[model samples]
Target: MALEQLSEVIQRCQALPENSYTSEDYDLFTVAGRTCIEEGNSLQLLSIVLDEKNQEIVQCMGWNLLPPLVQVLLKKENKDLPHCLAVFNHLIEVCRPKELLIGLLEQLEHDDPDTTAESLHVLLTPLQKLLNLGVRKASSLGMALSSVLEQLCKLPVPETTEQEQDDVFSLGQCCSELSAFIQPFVEEAQHNHIRGKDSAQMMGDLPHNEDELRTELLKCMQVLSRLLLGVQLRDMDTLPESPLRDFASSILIGDSLPALVHRPLLRHRHIPGFLEEEVRYPKESLACIAHLLFVHHLLADMFPTVYQELYEKTLVRVEDCGLPVDLLEIKSFLSVPQNLVKVMTICPHQNLRSKGLKVFQLSIDKFNTEAKYKFFLMLKTSNHSGVEGYIIKNIKNQIDSALKAEGGNVWFEGLHLLPLLRSVLMLPDGPETDLLQYMDIMESLNLLRYLVIRDKTGIWTELYKIEDTFLKPLRVGINMSRAHYERELLITKEDKKTKAKVSVGDEKLPNMTTDTHIKALHSALHTFDMIESVLVRIEELVD
Candidate 1:
């Protein structure tokens, strides 16, 4: 086409309403995009028309075309590529195709430092949005990111000048964007690999460019650690677990993560003349390592079995190294609950109980009684509330003794012990009458009335009826306990199990159905009625 005719076409295309960029009209935008690149004009004008400042354009283009634009830009190679780069940058920030953007980032490995650096900045800008979009399809994006990281690893590390060494150590602000962009992918890849899946093979392809890949991976990991640490103040459960969880866990358990985290870089240290300052590189590295370990522990807590395995693994190491048992006791305690419960029920190992109790004691010392109480309360509120209650009361006596040395602040802590008590009361009656009586003792000591009163009025009324005479007594008891109960009750041997049992004459198990048995049948019928009523209420509520 003649230049004048092409200009006319371009202008005509631009003049069309944004809706013109439909799937059927995508070819027009593609041609325009290419033509602008050839003519060294900003394709950003077309992108802006198609992407930003025009929702209709985006709707018309459909979501899929966004990736094609990125694919075209990444595949095309042009030095002094101002228009293409500008358009590419604009497209990333505006109409991001998460997988495609990630794929484009892989090209950073092939680009020079200046281009790679610029691309890195563009890539990092929309990362949180990309992650939020949940693009975990294991696209070619993973391999591409791994490649770019490999290139960074190959960058020659400059010798630190004494003055530079004295400054606060940072992972270089320029690399920050690149680091952030690659962190999640790296984590995802690592997780896939650890799970014995080939989904992470993309990351493995960069070993040929080992130095660059390794350096970039470390930088990405550091950025992730910082990001996670900043947000750690929020509830840990809210954070998504990616491969980074395993990466951190491996280091904490003295696994392969330390080597990966401390991989050698090309940077060198330099000493300045007449300076008395010593650069604390190792210290900073150790601090980062500790932070990573903490993150790993937080992740492991979500999976009790995994936490137990990792903890036991750590204990074996501590024993082999002749390390002070007390030094690692806290981690062991944190990891041992799952194992301790198994031991208590399955094998009844004395050693396990002793060690578990010792660890619990240490936890009480390290954290105030309030912290331990809250921690146990949280456990009771988790999905395993039933099991946690069983374990806590079994060790309640020891816990009480530990708290008593601090002047009995356990009950006053008021850490919402209701969930635990409710779980106990709901335990199925069988050969477990002793367990029931034990629960009764804890309830009496801890004042179950607080829980009953604090409960939702609707639920409380539905659950139990108070005789007019009992109401005043119950309210008075609750208030008295709320004001004066400074220490939780200590469970003694008698509290652990009751002597109550069914005597043959009193109520033959195979024959007589006594008043107690008849009352249970009535309770079951009442419960069924309540459930049917609640379901009807739920249906009404939905309507």
Candidate 2:
């Protein structure tokens, strides 16, 4: 109630042994144990405690003061928001001590006095109160939490360079404490924002929402993304297995990164008009999707699970997010066999895939021959049944491009995508739909034609394997095409007979020309002839 009483609590806190004190007692939810702010000197008491010049008094008051003050501040009265922010600023300053920050800046200027960065240990415990008070469920608490998060972003995170390639950043060290609280907001906000699109939105005009609650929530997500980026850049290449780097990743590489990655997809249009003008981490290319590209590269090698998840989500978002993941440039993300499966099954984005395969073909020499085996295993145990044929068709397109792309690279002699072709042609004898099986057979023959035409010597070099892989598919495609063509021809003839028998007057099929079985027969014959030519070329190369 008075300065003397505050001093006594401070003395007790100061006298405790290191590690003697417990975490904040969350039950202390009142202003000195009363709900009504009208009855206490809560504001005055906080101001006095904050003003105490003694470092020990301030540190002692910290664990006890803000957690309860926030209970009152988040009670939805407009009068209390400033008080909450003041308490928040006090705690942030206490943790990110001014002296510590000035010391970091001074070291940067001098670049001589080696100084260790401050640990954010002091802020972690008391700030856990926000976690206890779920921000999204309590609108008042969400507003207060948003204010605290914005202030956290404004603080400068300093960097220190140990070597030319090694730079460690400061605020990333604190993200672990903040990640849990921040992630919940992303899920709740995305849920609320995704409902109800009108005719205007369908026509590509912006969404309309009067609730400005999301502006702060969106700002928090952007801040969280940038904070995670700081954490990533701090320790990306840190010697494979260092505790410091690993600690930073534990926070940044959680569920948050994966969920936040879909931000551009879930919330791109919903971003309010005000935010569009001054977006901090603006959609340099579709916001979170673009940012996740950097995040994936930094953590993909160390955390394969992260890479797999990001790769899959990236597949779903390629069209909306503008195809930001470049697997060829970042070999680590695509190194896994399962990731290869994901790549093979991405159904949309033909142009992205086409460009990607060219890049991959150009870099085939950079990868070991082992990548070929991985792709073979992927297609052999192909998981995405719906899209594997499409994958096969696209690979032929790549092989054609590679054969067309003039280069003297040694890898060009061996198509990087050939193993996938092997797996496609070697499909098990099973009863899928006729159209599906026929499509698969045709894709194999077409790819084989391209291979035999461009690099007959390469095809012949693997002739023993190619015998089972190519010749069988060629036989199947030719036989199936003939059967299908003959059946359709008979059906058309029967239909004509039925129509003549009816003798209906002058409605002559509405002047529409037919796609006759003869046309299909011709196309099939052309494919069969090309495969035959490929076999001859292979024979010549072998001789």
Candidate 3:
């Protein structure tokens, strides 16, 4: 009955003139097609559509027939898989790419895991085909590509052995497909933007206008960079193999761009624009790339040049114009943790550094446990005392949470946690260390104090090593800093009194107030006092 109904609909649809099918006819056709699909006669249903005599019927079915056919493709053991692929491929050739993409994307979004997985397995090839068509046809396909890629980026990464084993459509496969899809854009970009080829001479259909093509390329780069970021967050271990990484490397670190050469000095106003296009990539894209490089430690040679360029640009922005009102809100600026560290540690402008620190703290708080662990591992060797100290504070939070956790936190337990703690606890200069200079030492002292008081057995066994390396050096350093600050405080007071007496006759001369130097000395003294207090408590706990 379903096959007969489908045949009648097909005949009626074919007999009518093109653009002559009414809404009722499409509804009837949809019902017949879905019924035949449900009744296991999909091959019979598609055989007619696939016939050369019924080409108009195929066009008439248009995108409306996609749903039933997609249902067939997604079925696990459908006997009509070959016919379904043929019909779907035919639709790809004749139907509007946009409608086909939209329909398929909706099917991919099905809530059931099995269905979504099946859709990915079946639709990935067709989607790639559509992408090729869209690119070659010079269609307004960038918008659709962006939506689809962004959705794919959000696909949950398999984290556990079981989840990975169970994954029917893994992120790795999706990334591979996306990487292939991005290749044409990369080639066209290199050809047109870098090689100076005319758009007409380029392969496939792309926008003729150079700027339009550039805009599309940037969008692709941005999303691909974001996909790389997702790979980093889920499993940094897999990032080396990620096809996304390869494309990013080709664009950002390729020979076309002077990734290794030092950028010459430019006027402050031009810095923004220059960095935005340092290598034909926009600033946000560069930030994502820099972030990937920083995490991988792959930029010991090339990345420093880019960092220098950014430092020079940021210095100008902070000194000449001051921090922007939306500086913290800027994704490019906040994307890289190391960039924030640079701002907080070395930027000459105090206000900008302060804002940078605020954003840094907020950003650190936003990462999940696994990301935080990976981030901390990458940043612990930053060589900046304050940054390392800030990282130690976060590590302390993780350890504390793990101690109190009922089941234990995977990231904050076992051998990995021990090494991280040891790194944070070590003082390179030992007893002669300048506690005032290295905030990390102070944070380390606090973390040590907490561990001694909390984990008597786990961390206690390492106490001898901690005492020799961390506690002893910290003790000597704290005493040195305390004595130094106290003496400086006294000298400043004496100098202030002397200056006041001398300036009595010179009313025009400013009196000695608590100036910047005095305020800094007082703050140092307070820090020393806090360190001493924490040290004493730690000794009491350990003894």
Tell me the whole-model lDDT of each prediction, alpha carbons only: 0.40, 0.45, 0.64
Off by over 4 Å in 3: 110-121, 134-139, 158-169, 192-211, 233-244, 247-284, 293-543
- Tens digits of per-residue lDDT for model 2, 1-543: 444445444455557654444443212322232332344545654564476553444543343344444444435465666655566456545533333222222222212112122212333333434333433333433444444444445444543334212324333343444555455554555555565345447788766542344444444445545443442233345444333344334433433455444443333345324445332334532343333444444455533353333433445433421322244345575564344344444724354456444443333323333443344344445545534555566556545555565543223347644555557655455322243334455555556656666663266566678776556555565567557766776776666655555534855442122345446556765655665565566556545
lDDT of 3 by residue, 395-425 (tens): 9988888777844666776655777778888
Q: Rank the candidates by TM-score, best first.
A: 3, 2, 1
How are the candidates ranked when ordered by lDDT, highest leading?
3, 2, 1
lDDT: the better of candidates 1 and 2: 2
Weakest lDDT window of 10 consecutive positions for candidate 2: 110-119
- lDDT per residue for candidate 1 within 17-68, as digits (tens), equals 7545444346554565455445544444444544434544433332333443
Error of 1 at 416 (Å): 79
Q: Estimate each model's TM-score.
A: 0.27, 0.32, 0.49
Q: Which numbered prediction scores highest in TM-score against the true structure?
A: 3
- Tell me each candidate's RMSD, in Å, in order: 22.5, 22.5, 22.4
Model 2 stretches with alpha carbons more than 4 Å out: 1-332, 335-365, 372-427, 430-477, 500-506, 509-526, 532-543
